[model samples]
Target: MRRVYSIVVSAGLAPALILGACLVLAVSPTLVPAELAGLVRYGPFLLALLGGVIGWWFNRGRAVFVMALLLICYWLLVGNGAGISAEGLAFLQIATLYLVPLNLLFLGFTAERGVLNPRGIARMLILGLQIFVMLMLAGQPDVGSALYRVLETRFFASTGVLGTMPHPAMIISAIAVVLLLIRHKPLETSFAAAIIAIDAATVMGAGVIQYGYLAATGVVLAGLAQEAWRMAFVDDLTGLPGRRALGHAMAELGNQYAIAMLDVDHFKKFNDTYGHDVGDIVLKKVARELARVGGGGKAYRYGGEEFAVLFAGRTAERAQEPLDALRQRIADNKITPPEKSKPVSVTISVGVCERDEDTTDPWAVLKSADQKLYRAKQSGRNRVVI
Candidate 1:
């Protein structure tokens, strides 16, 4: 409940600040015509007080700070020319409300550093506007007019889901992004396509061009493209580089690098006893340990139960010391699997090879490493041999 309250408070700060300013300035008998003062002052004061409490309670200090500034600016500089009539006052109130919710929506969905979520947050917002249009369709004479009516409609409608808040459309887009990240079905195909179509339809049907929504679409598409690249070159289970990625790393390393091929010993037996799920956990643990062990070097999941590590700008002799230390650390570390009594104690067999400008290509170096790995496995499953 406290956390929920905090979220609400954080969410409400901006509007509260804006409304509070309008109320204090407009209601002052000295600041405006007396006939226009009552509603202008009272209505916003109530809202501002409500929003301020929520903002303060929620720890939205940044918002509060900004809101205070906006309030002060408007009151001192813009108040007289800003108008004090009922219609004018209402417009101010509604516009503030509209801006607040939109700001919150952006804050909630954006990444910490301002990278937009690449899954159509914009399209969903437009779809929401379309829904709002449909809801008020009967009351309005034309679609364009209904779409254009946001400034007029915002005050009352902003309280509803389709207004300032992220509507179902936004949520759907977010879900699609998550799906793409996790490789869940429908996200890559039908759902994504449908979202695009709906947004286009809404834009055309309502006769409104939403640039924000288009921008969001672009972001989500970029994210989807990034996801695709990861899928092509990253191991899904451990989120490490894959064989293709290893090749890329080797190319970058050129001739001045050593490669170590790592294979877990008795992995098949371990999987049979622990079941594939626990086996997966063990593999992930091993991968993490290898990553930690490799430090600045690159590690790859070279297909099932086998791994590769590439050390750039290092000779075989230079790589040997850390590689040996890594072997010992793997032997020493306690790795546990899910629902297991003791960690599925494991060690790796590694084969090392270096790329030389005179002789070895990436493939040859890899082949040599594979041969060495075979020798290590053949001799003993728990040792590293070069």
Candidate 2:
């Protein structure tokens, strides 16, 4: 049953079906005037449809399923109803009744899953479409009346990206904010930055004060959210992967790669000799070196006096050169320990293992790596063993 439902949700038919129904109602020309009220009346259904789709996409069962059902109810409530017009409500129904909810739910779901990287660039792309639609609406011949119609009735108000794109120039600013937030990384490339700037200008030209404020606030909020997420998944002390981050990464990567457990040799002894503060400094220095050496692979602080490195698409034996160089780098570099009043050096031991395809599990692979690490320590103070 669960599998069947998920399949249904993932289908493109979900949104397209809703849109088709609206299109049918639109072409038939009902006596009921399709006004903003009628459009707003069905907003919940739109939201539900979106939520369900997103839920299905991200495997979020309950929220998505519930939203889909609620949306169906909305369709029933507004069907062939009096006071709904066929013409005026055409775009309203399609956008508010369908697109808004679908996009909102999808966006929220993707964000919640921590998969908002470039892989999900489609989310950002849809947002761009919404912005275009809003701009078109704002430029309508009777801009004032259209604005009043969309805003006053709260048509598609439930939609998260601040109603349809067509607000005053100021509203463009708000859209800019939404765009920035939805982006995984801050815009740095020249073309990207220029596009963003142009989008902002369009919003300002629309003359929507609230839009400007919302855009600014949304950008800041998105940045904050991104930072908060990073902190949640990052190690503060060593700048290595924190335990929580490691878990999240494992959940994401599953059994697709190799695991290497690396530990600083005699870490506790160093702390005892140099004090915990200096110990912390040494750990950070080591983490930096590890991150630098690992390249492309992730480095994590597994726990006290221990670090973990994950190498993608490689076997344990393949890590020999990199691990050897890492150990050598640490031994050769002169690290100025914090409050140590002098420079010092440190060494690290590494245990690496490729994922056993027959028994593909991170924990098991990690255990194997740990065992190898133990062997390295037993063999000598500083070395890499598989």
Candidate 3:
């Protein structure tokens, strides 16, 4: 159950759930009331706008670009603002069918350098250029017809399972989906969901296209939210919960919980002797051992070269055995520094305290643990004190 929960949350469960709701509504139109007719028409535009604001605020270039693309495509294909000729409309439909997946692939593969950076601006300009060229071709009936013929040409057999989607578009969407799956990060998974939604919009009837785009926009928004949360509460370098998360956990501690403070011994010396890069490797190695700590303890990166473990229902004496084992394991592990022939070992010192009659507050218990940590360092590094 825990593994399942981790997988779902890690992959942006909120967005997936939203997409599933949209799919259900699409299949059973009666579930939607007549009062929601206006919402159904305009919700995608509103949501996309909101998503754009979030992307910009968070400086997530991919989200911003994707939201903009979704808004423009929704406006062009569904809103039909220009009242173009039937041939132009048909051309746009096919063009977007191809362009959406291509844009998704580009955004999925690219790094998020930020929305206002030079590279981001270049990406935006490139997308604008494509739109301009598409509009120019769409205005010329003969050119539009020629391109439409080329785009509509089938590269594979059209089976009943494939519906009426163009083979080329299907192929592009398939490739994008497969690559996104292989990447398997939260943002990449969201992109894969969006591509699938767009493809469904293409193969299904026009009535469902808006829902598909809406789901795509929703997933992007959800991904941005998840990333922002992670940035606030997770240590990027160590991949552990950060100090803010520790504070939250501490707030919920019971009366008998244990708090252990840990610090890498002589970390500054390691950084000075080898380099900051080698120091980083040492910290990562220590963090890995801490993450695997026993006794139902949760590890957190408290700050530079320091970490904390919380044993929610355990006493200080009960926590000593596991903490000592962790210290020994880290002391036994050796790290090979770059350009160095011999491997060097890293060690950590730990101090533990539990809630008691004299120190009932969690903060006080933590402070006591820190004081004990100092004593442990004074006595000798690479040891645990309780």
Which of the predicted structures, 1 or 3, would earn the higher TM-score when compared with the native?
Answer: 3
Comparison by lDDT, 2 against 3, better one: 3
Q: Order of all candidates by lDDT, from best down to worst?
A: 3, 2, 1
- Candidate 2: residue 149 lDDT (0-100): 53
Ranking by TM-score: 3, 1, 2
TM-score of each: 0.51, 0.48, 0.92
Q: Worst ten-residue run, lDDT, model 3? A: 1-10
Instruction: For model 1, give the 10-residue run with minimal summed lDDT.
Output: 206-215
lDDT of 1: 0.53
Q: Which stretches of candidate 2 lie over 4 Å from their true place?
A: 1-206, 252-256, 338-342, 357-359
Report how far off residue 27 is in candidate 3 (Å). Answer: 0.9
In candidate 1, which residue ranges exceed 4 Å CA deviation? 1-209
In candidate 2, what are the lDDT values of residues 151-207, reduced to their tens digit?
A: 434423444334434433224334533553455232111112222322332323323
Best by lDDT: 3
lDDT of each: 0.53, 0.54, 0.85
